[model samples]
Target: MDMPRPYRSVLYIPASKERALDKARSLDVDAIIFDLEDAVTPDAKVEARDTLKAALKEGGYGARAKIIRLNGLDSAWGREDAEAMKDAEADAFLLPKVSSAADVEALAAIIGKDKDIWAMIETPMGVMKAEEIAAHPQMKGFVAGTNDLAKELNCRFRADRLPMITSLSMMLLAAKAHGIVAIDGVYNQFKDDEGLAAECAQGRDMGFEGKTLIHPAQVAVCNEAFSPSAEEIDLAERQIAAFEETEASGQGVAVVDGKIVENLHVETARKILALAEAVSAR
Candidate 1:
């Protein structure tokens, strides 16, 4: 398996705001999405595109993966946005409302195979076709757009997020099946640290690689929540040691912390350790 990239907190910065773009350079985020859609007003779309081009040209984002979220191909600004940023120093192009494999193919055609493509699975159609979209050769990741999904589903938002659970699960399954990263949607309440923490924990349990953030304030919390805890690291180390000892003795199972440790369990423990190492290295 490919080593997992540390994507604990992917922050979204509106391309239209120069100050926000400048501020992002100093933010401790795993990745920054320079957004040209949704965050940019329709009237300011062209200017935002120009601003993003210049920002990319300036090139000060260190280590943090730089991504550009373009308007949908169906939208008037989408093509121009992609064309303008084609040579920009970005790691990926995030396409909003991607509902099929063809969408990925079409985007790959425009952006070329050199850049990664992160698709937003926002609508009902997107969720339904997630597998096909994920299987696309050019797809690099999936970002769940829970707010738009809620609007499309006409479902009430709850603290537990019961209504969108199915859609989230489907996206996660597809991402894991295809070995691509799956990012949870943004938490609307940026001020609600408690709420954001809860949601982050939920997303981590649901197997999401990270959470898409709307504010820099949420970065630390999201990063901490997604990363393996110290206790978890210690436990994983113990599990690996125990499993190795047992394997040397020709035993198929080992015991760690009064729990049975098998090959599958050891594999999971190793992944946790690898994730911790990856995060620390970053």
Candidate 2:
């Protein structure tokens, strides 16, 4: 089996900003999304792509997954953005406001079938067709675009995110089903570390591999929330040891802290340990 890649904290850095791109190299982030979409003004779109391409060529980001978020094909500069950076040193290309599998296919057509595609599930139609998008052969991830979804759905923002749960679940389900990464939306309040931590905890509980961040300051909290805690790491180890003992004895289950450790639990426990290792390696 392939070792799981940790996506605990994915930060959006505007491609046009040279300083921000350089600063991102040192952040405690698992991935960097070099944004060419909403973060850039229309006039600077082409310039941003070139800047990002040049920056990537100069290379210093290390092992952090470098994802480039492209403008949608519906936009004037989207095709050009993709074409210009198709050969850039990026881990993946994020398609903004992806509404269906066809959107993914269009990017594939432009960038060729070998490239990885990550979809932004922020529209009502995008959430509705999430399964189709996730099933695309080139699809590698789904990022929740909660801000846009709320705007489109005409829903009020709540700390509990009650309005966005259904949509979130749909996108998450699609990603989990297809064995792709699912990232939670940005927690807009940059200065409110408490709120960011709370939301990050909520997202981690909801099975999101990571939270997409808007600011560099948010990286520490997001990584802490998503990573396996010491207690969790201990428990995972115990579960694996106990389960292995039981299996050697020709049993199908084991007990750890009064809980049953079946094959599925062992599988989860091993993944937790693997993820911890990945985070440590990072």
Candidate that scores best on TM-score: 2
Candidate 1 on 1-282: residue-level lDDT in tens?
346679999999999999999999998889999999999999999999889888888988888989899999999999888888888889999999998999888888887887789999999999999999999877889999999999999999999999999999999999999989899999999999999999999999999989999989999999999999999999999999999998899956799878999889889998998899888888
Off by over 4 Å in 2: 251-253
| Candidate 1 backbone collisions, by pair | none
TM-score of each: 0.97, 0.98
Q: Per-residue lDDT for 81-119 in model 2, tens only?
A: 889988999999999999989999999999998999999
Q: All models: lDDT?
A: 0.92, 0.93
Among all windows of 10 consecutive residues in model 2, the one with the lowest summed lDDT is 1-10
Scored by lDDT, the top model is: 2
